[model samples]
Target: MASPRRRAAASPALAAFGRQFRRYRERAGLSQTRVAQRTGKTASFVSQIESGKKRCRREFVEIMDPELRAGGVLLGLYDDLNGDGQMGFPTWFDWPEIEIEADLLVTWQHTVVPGLLQIDGYARTFLSTDEAVLARLARQEILNRDVPAPTSLIALLSEHVLHHFVGSQKIMREQLEHVLAMSEVPHVTVQVVVNEDGMPAGNGGSFVLASMKDRSEVAYLETAVRGLTTDDPQDLAEIAHTLDKLRRNALPVGMSRSLIRKVMEEKWT
Candidate 1:
């Protein structure tokens, strides 16, 4: 017997595009085989593209543009995916592509819950805008992908994150429960930095350190208005050092969960 075909993991952006492509193809009343025939590829190939296992080729996009009547929508996505610089995602401010491809993700959040770890209600509370909410929800897909190697995430959250009420007490309670549940996932580790620890390292702001498949590293820093992603050796080293120090000061996993539960019960309740 042959082994089952491995499903491909997709970046948040690619996943969104795949969803759009599938929707447009279905709305056009075309089957995968028919689309494949039009594009001169196998049905399996078309399926892979639509499922985000394989990238949509430019030629295929050219054919699909007219077949699906997308009116350049498909081409625009193609350009963005290929990094041709013609189309950019205005709402997705963070480096989702790198985040999805990372083998290890270390995050430090001083205020709110990190986007990937947030529950819908928690996210919706602070996101406010529909576009921002959708973009954040889309980024969560990386945590749920089961194939192409699951990314390991270590999140060091300030204890204040547990006490900070975004929407309501109920929302905060549910958010804490969500985090406790997520920490149970094999690839995810959640730790808390207690307020008593004085000023933690990297108290400057929130940031993410992504260790990519190729052994390269990148750091993402967020500001009031925008985010910055850098692979500069010095920046990566500095951010990595800060993350290491923060992790050292954070509570152990079991204690963190206990703290979260305590906060949920005592404060949020």
Candidate 2:
């Protein structure tokens, strides 16, 4: 028999909640079939909920909380997912909540350094306002989480990012050094696509793909004035394929670091 297929999540928040629910269920030592039986649903339905392919209703949470001994933990997470917490974010973007729950992050940037890897001065140059700068810095918390669930980052940068001179010669130098330092982290990988590489994939703009612990993926696209986050399976698949192509075409990690060091010595000095 063929193995069952896995599905991507419908949204980042839903995927996060599903992960929490699954963890609690496992802690309670109950199977999806048993959970379904208790809630008047099928094992398939429970599977979908845990995979984030199906929504978990309030009624389901009510039934699950006591059974799983979650002590209202699941309900609290559900409320957070449903709340209006996007007021301070940029328009049409809901990535912050999703980013918090992602176990893997893949980013492709053609212009500036990816946000998570950017230094304070470099980030301030692009963010424009104090609040915006703080907000951008706030997102970096995921990279340094104290918990066991560390977020792994794979950042792909175009060769131009090192030479672009974001703030000043000094700031750029500091920023590049910061990138080098971040790459030393066990969970972070940095690669560069040299100008000669000639537009491998995702060359039009920048995007980030976040993978939840459950293996469901979501994607975010950003431009000069607009940003969008999507959980559509087809969109996520296409983005993933493009990212894979970019990864294959980019310089390997060691060589990329060498390239950065060479640029710093030649240009920044």
Give the best candidate by TM-score: 2
Per-prediction TM-score, please? 0.65, 0.70
Q: Please write out the lDDT profile of model 1 over residues 107-212, one tens digit for every residue.
A: 9998999999987888898877989988888888888887877789999999888877798888888889999999999999999987565665767789988776
How many backbone clashes does every candidate have?
A: 0, 0
After TM-score superposition, what is the CA distance of residue 137 in candidate 2 from its true location, in Å? 1.3
| Residue pairs with clashing backbones, model 2 | none
Tens-digit per-residue lDDT, 173-202, candidate 2: 888898999999999999997656465577
For candidate 1, list the clashing residue pairs, or say none: none
Model 2 residue runs over 4 Å out of place are 1-5, 8-93, 195-199
At residue 36, candidate 1 shows an lDDT of 87
Q: What are the C-alpha RMSDs, in order, of all predicted structures? A: 7.7, 7.8
TM-score of 2: 0.70
Predictions in order: lDDT: 0.79, 0.80
